[model samples]
Target: MVTSEKNIQMIMELADAFGPSGFEDDVLTVARKWAEGLGTIEEDHMRNLYIHRKENTGNKPVIMLDAHSDEVGFMIHSIKPNGTLRFVTLGRFANIAMSSADVLVRNALGEYIPGVIAAKPVHFMSESERAKGGVPEISSMVIDIGATSAEEAVNRFHIRIGEPGVPATKCRYDAENDVMFGKGFDCRIGCAAVIETLRRLEGMDLPCDVIGVLSSQEEVGERGCKVSVKHANPSIAFVFEGCPADDTFTEPYAIQTALKKGPMLRFMDVSVICSPRYQRYVLDLASEKGIAAQASVREGGGNNGAIINTALDGTPVVVAGVPTRYIHSMNCITSGYDFEETVKLAVATVTSMTPEQIAKF
Candidate 1:
């Protein structure tokens, strides 16, 4: 009945949908269906879906809200004569995370066949090999679909090379604790934020016209965002991300992104240094509004902001990262409160902005 619960349902469905870079049809379907009454929807050849808000006035300055729809997934590269599948990644995948994972492969018939990522039995490993100390190599990995041979896999399972695959993890929400566990939060959570932000702004008169783009192929490189920026010529942009949480691995003094924190606004990631003026505005606004937020200077990772900020002769951009743990793996965890706060901060920041104030940034 509450705002977070309603959006969690959307996030669950988004996370469950099978989509990878260049193969985001199912994810786009979930977004388009959710956007039905909220806007005019349009998409490009690359499967980037755009939601043009109902209250948008073309006369106003444009505010582009961006999130990638594609999750880190894999494509079947070949079927061994013995029936297991060899795969190549569509995006960055944790090598250890892939071994023994429950996965669903898209078949030639457009059906998903449940399978398990194969791994050598512990008993079969030599002590010397065990000492090597790292995840199994991709060449040593395969997806077993319970088939006897390559012919059976293709003929009966209808699976073939180039088909996409994603983790088969189901979504779970603990309403009492306000926590979410699932897969694909790396960006599906971001996709949900874009939708929720746009939905909240519907029917309200604002300083800028807001357009939400559920971009594709972000994990493969910010490919879809490149096309989205060309379509959305905006004066400013909000890049929402489901960023990695550092609470578990980071030292106490170095912790930047952590679960239960409202949102992690990054000053720099590997690809882009955020606009200082806009970043400062959000930070100050969060303080004024009592919205909990953390600022981080990431030593690694990238997002669509890197590409969008440099477009249309430069646009001011700030990335709001929702702290998520174990992202890009089979299982991920995020705080529902963090998600809600992110939506709140974004709504307030955009609504409170003015053309003159933006120019100063």
Candidate 2:
């Protein structure tokens, strides 16, 4: 069994990898390496990694733990006449958070070119313009690469249309306070939980087959899970994710979720209504095991949507997520305690289920 420190190191490695929506190859490499010697691993055409372990062969319902490998990023659209690059967002991005942010532009040769999201200078802008609310439109945004002309910029850096650009940052751990700060924690944390669980379950005597899916294109709309669900055909599934915490000094009701509260057991989401029976089962398991957990009612967003109705012909689906702050932004934060709880909850929930128990749902 891997230690908590090793699991945390794996998560940090994943968070540092550059695997935006359509470019998940690098992240997959790391996942594949960690999944070795644990189970049967495969990568689909869509770049989704599926790791399966055949423990009990009694026709038990398959259980899948899903997490997306992609993060919010951008794609280059055009090179401007003045050497600045015009780019379009690949996934959801908070435009207000894009200003003055450093970004990494991945060229065709797999090199990282450093650039910063350019914004209009306050000195040149009128007070009225500065007072305008909300983020500026994409048309008004450009990436500054320190080039004086388009020719020089293109020659020095292979900036082309459709290349992926990600936030240029590294995962940082605060040893004194035991906090980790990083980008892409939204789903990376979830991915880490899935992988850690798989590693933990290695060689254990279990009653059912378990599948670990590092899904793709989730930030684009859970498209990768749609494919994997169909292929694995799991009877019961858990979609692990990181939910945005509403803790910016907001009102109580406005603060939808919070960190360090264990996994949030989502009852309903925008895409999928979790099976009542499975929700109860998960809650009961957490209670029985004395695991830290929180109940959530999400109106929108969760991967349960794709898993519940997509493949396996209406299988029971449950969502377990860690509360994250500033989701989809460059500085998403999550508690290490919450992350570890998510892993424990998933392992316990899956280990406790029997074929009959799963099929009843």
Candidate 3:
């Protein structure tokens, strides 16, 4: 089973998990469940999850496969007297697309309460507001959960001052098109790839020991990989991401990341330049193995790879990203074909990597 039914289920579950920056318990819950038999799982105080392969010999160099578990979301800042919740952005949400969107707020009781990001309706807007004709500031919006007063909001709804919330979009797959629609594809899809890659390499005897890290709080910054990298101390790393696709808006010749093309192998983004020799090696290997892959030179955007590349004596790292459209917004689209190719490319990479190749890089 190349891209098995379980793999698709895992992708949907990971993408559907309600996880925000600094609030990743739900995401880790799903990750651990799917990764049950793959390795010995351990988590940190900051909720960085590590999966140590059971076949590791402890004598070989460590290889780290990393994907963050957090997504762009909102955090409750204060509740107005009218029972409306004011919020602050967590990570980089597409604020322009946020008004009137459905969200699930995590209340103090650890339950998700449904809400809508409400803004003043057109009838209530002043002439100036209508003439200005621009998107409202996120600060001006409120999350309404049907409570009529602050007392009701707190006492009845259990809403608190610092709860996190994410888009209430569920995952849906189009089997005919091999596409997926959902929220939080920024890194959840990447998380699925890491898990599936580990599963594929389960019984193999490789030149290096591998560890899978479902890191946390990446949308806020590259924070989780800082800890995960130190814990794993890998000599080399493979970072996976659901990168923003440029196909929809970019010029015809400039499109590098497109849905259904393959996983993107980025040489450089805003954060860090990837290991050139290693990137070339993997691209060449993909060609030799006839695996679909895309090469990208991004103008903006970053990932856990930047942190891992500088973590310990500068580990050699490459990022294999699934091309996702409309990331950082409430909803996103990605291709199942891209995901499958990502897993295949990664599996081929680790299986072919050796100590000699590492020395050259």
What are the Cα lDDT values of the candidates? 0.90, 0.81, 0.92
Index of the highest-lDDT prediction: 3
Q: What TM-scores do the predictions have?
A: 0.98, 0.94, 0.98
**lDDT for position 206 in model 2:** 77
Per-residue lDDT of model 3, residues 17-75, tens digit only: 99999989999999999998998999998899999999999889998999999999999
Off by over 4 Å in 3: none
lDDT of 2 by residue, 1-361 (tens): 2226777788888888899998999999988777777777899999888988745353757788888899989988888889999888877887787988889998767799999999787777877777885347766899888877888777878677889988987988764554678888878888888888887787787777888888898888777877888877787888888777766766877555677768888788777788889888998889898888888787767674455455667888888888888877777777788888889999998888787887787
| Least accurate 10 contiguous residues by lDDT in model 1 | 1-10
**Which residue pairs of candidate 3 clash?**
none
- Name the better of 1 and 2 by TM-score: 1
Measured by TM-score, how close is model 3 to the native structure? 0.98
